[model samples]
Target: MITFNRVRSSILKAKDHRRQLLGIHETDVLRASIAEAPHFRALLSEIQAEAERARREPAPELSFTDFHLFAAQGTRIEYEKPYFERRGRLLALALEAWLHPEQKDLDALQNEIWMLCNEYSWALPAHLPYTLEGVASSRVTMPEVVDLFASETAHALAETLYLLEGRLNPWVVHRVREEIERRIFRPMFDTPNTFPWESSTNNWSAVCGGAVGMAALLLVDDRERLAGMTDRVIRAMGSFLEGYEDDGCCAEGVGYWNYGFGYYVYFAEMLYEFTNGKLNLLQGDKIRRIASFPAAVALTAPLYVNFSDCSETYVPNTGLVSRLHRRLGQPVPEMTAVPSLHADHCYRFPHTVRNLLWTDASLLHQPAAEGTFTFPDTAWIIDKHRLAGGLFAFAAKGGHNDEPHNHNDLGHFILHAAGETLLSDLGAGVYTRDYFREGRYTYLHNASEGHSVPLINGLPQAADREHEAAVLKQEVAPDSRLVYSLDLTGAYPKNSGLRSYIRTFEWSGQAEREEAHLRVNDSFTFAEAVNGVEEFFISLQRPILSPGSVTWRGQTGEVKLTYDADTFSAEAEVIESLDHGSHPLTVHRLRLRAGRVPGEASWSFLFTARAL
Candidate 1:
């Protein structure tokens, strides 16, 4: 479980060390920008309207409401915790207090706010507490509440606070600087782990912890500590980056990519801002390339197979795209709604329609696609469309188990055919409750059934020793053949005789025919205690259709497709039994496993044709 003391100590030390090394003071760049932005001006107007509504409306009668009871036993609250929900409501009231000082019930509002806070304090474990209210409230204060509430919450809250007030809050400035110093300078210093909440590669521990360290540097108050923390966070981020093959696929699925990749972008943005454009996170081009992740899902329409936990069928957050656009210094034409906690006000149809319109408009202007590029451990091939045609993209992973959101899927690729995605990678699932952490459905996040290579043993690559693994080498040949060499040979330490493993994806495409070729190769060293094995599997999915003949080539999985207009049907899958029953929705997953683990093995999938 994560501990507050560890987090507090690390943050404090980093802050102190930063002060000694940077010889600088807090600078309020983000705070001032937020105050002045046109977007913020619009947001303020919205807040004022809500405040007016709350005032004109009769105040609800107060009672000794059992906040915990509401969270635990209440049928409505049982589905979702009331702690964060009530906190959001309370923060809204507080904002009303801040905006309209003339309200005679200022004391009442403050009292109610404190009561809500106290309730959260009681609901959460001692280590975690409520920090900030929500968007309308102060971002800086939220981090404090997070830190005070729980270690994980604190880390997340700290990151947001660091972004909002590194220059404004003396406490934050000092704390960040101090923590950096302790973690960086102290030889034995280690970062805090998620307590109460188990530490996972996809959770608040790795992603949020890394963000906190990166944000510390922006305050300009703790140079020494910031340097140390920066070193650790960057290395961690680097390790995560190395895990992706060129295709920009994440094994934890789209949900995890959002969690892990979201923070990755957050930290990169902080670094870019703090360095005054000196250290560009986009310099490596790896993070920017991840843009394809959202693009992949977006391009695959109708089915919108975002299968996992309780995640929405369609993503509600477009703010991320907007943020990315800002980072890339380009306009994100199609953005509908930003993620929100409030269910009632969250989904905006206008924004959604606008995004769809923008997508259609952008597709009209085809830009010349570029060549394949290789990052530390990944390879990417972009099929840009200058006109209206298929845009095929591929990402091959060659990184280690230690990569952030790393999964066992090393050779996953997402395919965009015609104007739609024929083969795709499912994004993410829901985050509320323990859904994001535990649940056997967690296997949904493993590499086996994901859009990549699956090991027969059903063990995840980063299931153990998650932080230290790495991709020792990777190579992408001019012939479009991609090879990834990993050190996971030692992933199963109990079977130590395992030496090395290699996964290769060779891609060949005929631009004129819109057909592509995929060749997969796996090589592994045998361990005395364990038998070597190999498996070849591929998952092919198209939007829900009826009575369709899904044909494939016997040699290299070749496909010739034809759809009857009369047989077309649009249906969705309901999670009842294990298989789809006569429903219009159908998903076909084929697995070919070889019990023998050869020192070297190869398999291939060739796409020779396409049918709309």
Candidate 2:
């Protein structure tokens, strides 16, 4: 058992022997990587063209007032998000141009660099807490501080100074370092990060701590002081790790597991290399299991458990995934899609840079994994069947409602057949102030109603510590049927007149026949007769309805869901996906409503998700 505190004590001794081993120095990152790598020069060239195009357009007007405007508009993706992204990209271009000394317009980049260095605070107005908002007529009650993005913003400046040490004007580096100390270092490390990120169990701990830690390691001249600061960061990461169950489940969803954990690993790699492997940060069973999450949860190439605020269509860093696979001996997930190394999109920087630096092309050649994975830590069951003719899969979850990025979907499941999504989990919606404000579960995607679960007497599942699910049983028969049952009694309001909710899914696959199907049975006991129970299954494809069956036509093939017309009725509705998402998406909500029943009743349906 390696305690991070003990690691910190070792790191306190690290400064005495600190020497850079990051494969390339601040100066050679551009030159050496571009020379050795195939994709490196091309990405840099695209970035260069972007900077060239940007040279003609005046930078967008910046205002602290406009930054806070999105908070009132119920959107975080609109104005400020793009504006800061532009700023970060612009900074990267300047650094890139400096790295490419052959470029003719080096001074043009220097000008853009100066303009950015002059901005008030790199922190976005939208991320400001009421206390941190730089409002006039205010005696700031709290310390004038740095938020998560601001930490990265500061790192960008520090990283620029380090990378372009002699090439840039001396004044630019001095100004950047001064601001890093003023806005980031003094406020964050001088006092301490009592800000919730210090103890966060999610991405916050990694991005905030890792970004600032990289800055301290690169920019700070005080070796002993830097060691102490690095010591503190290791301790915060322990908090992130301590919250994980022994199963290495990232309850936040696969998207965030990639995002947050990516940063943690990024910092780990930097330290590991810097110490020449003396500090083995990648050690431990918890880490290996955490690294294996994507494979366990993935339903297909691009789909996985979108449990919390996680996304369904996401880009996993092939470099990071490959490294983890080599280390843990776990299967590398399929990631044929490429990723941008631009700073505008990264909550990950110095680490995301690894995507370009360490990506192994062989990762794409890894064999596909097909089998049953049971994560009892979070009560999630994933079964992938790779028949000779095609692929079919099913996934279901039964965790508490109070998970990180919590959603009120306890007994939700996803199904895929004929290589297309049939039943789906509409992952995260747009991020608005209200999304995180009061009444979050009211959002359909966050509520139980949006999931494939029954609403008891019109009351959706509750969202608190008390509302949770207990796994009753799980049977895995690989080549046959896989049945999983969970007790959902604790998921709803205690006084909702619902006595129990036992949701079960029996998935069967006939690999030899290229056929796959599922049976869902939900048995409930109520304190009294209820209004109605609606069972919903979300899908990417629209289903055509007949009397007793609904057939969903997708790219792969058609999936037919059959039920007794006399026992239930079905309907469908189309809803908008998240606005300004990475890709445009549309999905159908297929609802099956059963008439009111007595205190004790059961409802069941059958569907063929995959078949030849």
Candidate 3:
């Protein structure tokens, strides 16, 4: 059995010896390294630019109007925009102060840190327990709860104190430690389970546990207390790992794989350092497979298989990927672009710091991954073909509706050709109270209506754990074709009259001929004649409907979807919606309407993509 006994022993031995992890603790040496490294020049410029921006802007006040909006109304972005901006500013200003040691930067950093220290709760209102709204409304009195961001705030503050201790005013430094201890350490240690996330199997477990554990390592000096706390954290980390099956697929999709797994890696690095390399969490076959998920899911340089709540655009953290590559000898996708300073509005401290510490130039030069990757445990198949035309990638899923960040989209697929996603997954809807509550499926992105699947009796797929898709058959040819079939009958309710619904996808590609075709065949059986059936396919580009087919043209290529005109009629509808970023955009939904059909019927549509 794998255990952290060695970690506990190592921590017991290092009784007052505070260790620096992941980066140099001394400011002067760290600054010198940053100044001398050529690759770090761009990062330095970003920090400097953010410093200027921070200097120009006054910190936005976390006001009553904004803070109460989540409770008063169901909206979140009104408060979150300024809330994250404050954190981002603090991160940039602090890093700038540390690097340059300028008096002005230091002064601004002190003020930002002070402002953060004074906040009522480091946890966002959205993360608070629903019953605690009254306390949040007061904006002052509340029990300490270590949500994802609150724990992260504790780590950020503790690390700041660790790195810039002597430079900062004694009062500011003292207050920083006091706040973290009172807010994070005391609550977690005093009451073992301050939040239910300790046992959660999603990103919450990793983010909250990892952040608090890392903060404890950075702040707590008592050996016995640290060991007890660290043991609990290790258990939580284990729970996080249990969330993934043997195949190591993240059902929450790529964006979350970067997030939840990213934190696990960060905490692992710290633990490895704390134990003087005695406890290596990055070892083992399971972790190596988990580390390879991003490369396996990459459809293009900028896109990934965006199932569940993942964003269509996924930017791998270069530093984290490089660290994994160097540690485990795993392959990483070629990442040419660096994340901008504000790319992450939250300004995650560990991610930003590691982006400077762990990046390796050689790792960034690897070729993009190609060919088929399958995860039967999670029921995901991704195939990328490097054709003469460009690149043709097809991804599909057969998981249940009640996944983490669940969407009722079993048997949903994405088709990417050349540089465009002809048939797309809507990715994430804008996060709000209603978006996560009873009205969740009413949103376009969460409902099956927005996916490339068929509805039963004019009803969308249900959102229950039992509403799942079972893999009926799967095939991967050497280089020419891939086939996947799913039994989607359970995805709909009995009242919908659905007896059995089988979805099969045949993806065939010929690189030499620059042609790729995806055949989506759905066979349905009903106990009685259904009201009607509608097949919906989502795309970023508007579809042009012709006699018997619909064509979506992209800049470099186009996808022509041919269906039986005699059985179905096609039309295009535009939905004013939000992307993963919550940016307003128009989504083109192609609907194939079918009249009342017999108890047994089948629909097949062939999607052809070739060089334009």
lDDT of 2 by residue, 1-612 (tens): 455555555556564333453445554564665556664556566566667767766676666566556656655655665556565555556546655766655565566667766766666655665433445433222224456777777666666666555777777777778777777777767774366677887788887787787788777767567767777777667777876788988888777787677768777776776555666668888888899988777655666656677777665777788777776676777676445555225434554455555666667634447888888988888888875445678888998988887889999988878666678787777666777778687777787877877777777888988889999989966666899999999998987788888988899878656678888888989888655777788887888999999988777655788887887888888876652253566768888888877788886788876544
Which 10 consecutive residues of model 1 have the lowest summed lDDT? 574-583
lDDT of 3 by residue, 1-612 (tens): 345576568788763345567645675776687688776677789888887888887898989788778887878888888878888887888787767665543777788889988887788878775555555664334537678888888888877877666788889988888888888887778664446788889998899888898888887878888888888887888889999988989999888988888999998888778877766778788899999999998866677889998888877788899899988988897686556676687889888878877777666646568888999989999988878767788999988989999989999999999867789999899898988889989989999998988777878999989999999989876765698999999999878888889999999887767978999998988888655788999999999999899999998878999999999988899999987668897999999999988899988999998768
Estimate TM-scores for all models. Answer: 0.49, 0.91, 0.95
Candidate 2 local lDDT, residue 108:
56
Instruction: List the candidate numbers ranked by lDDT, top first.
Output: 3, 2, 1
Q: Tell me the whole-model lDDT of each prediction, alpha carbons only.
A: 0.39, 0.71, 0.83
Residue 570 displacement in candidate 2 (angstroms): 1.3
Give me the displacement of residue 493 in model 3, in angstroms.
1.0
- Which window of 10 residues has the lowest lDDT sum in candidate 3? 134-143
Between candidates 1 and 2, the one scoring higher on TM-score is 2
What are the RMSDs of all candidates, in order? 11.8, 3.2, 2.4
Give the top-scoring candidate (TM-score): 3
Question: lDDT value for candidate 1?
Answer: 0.39
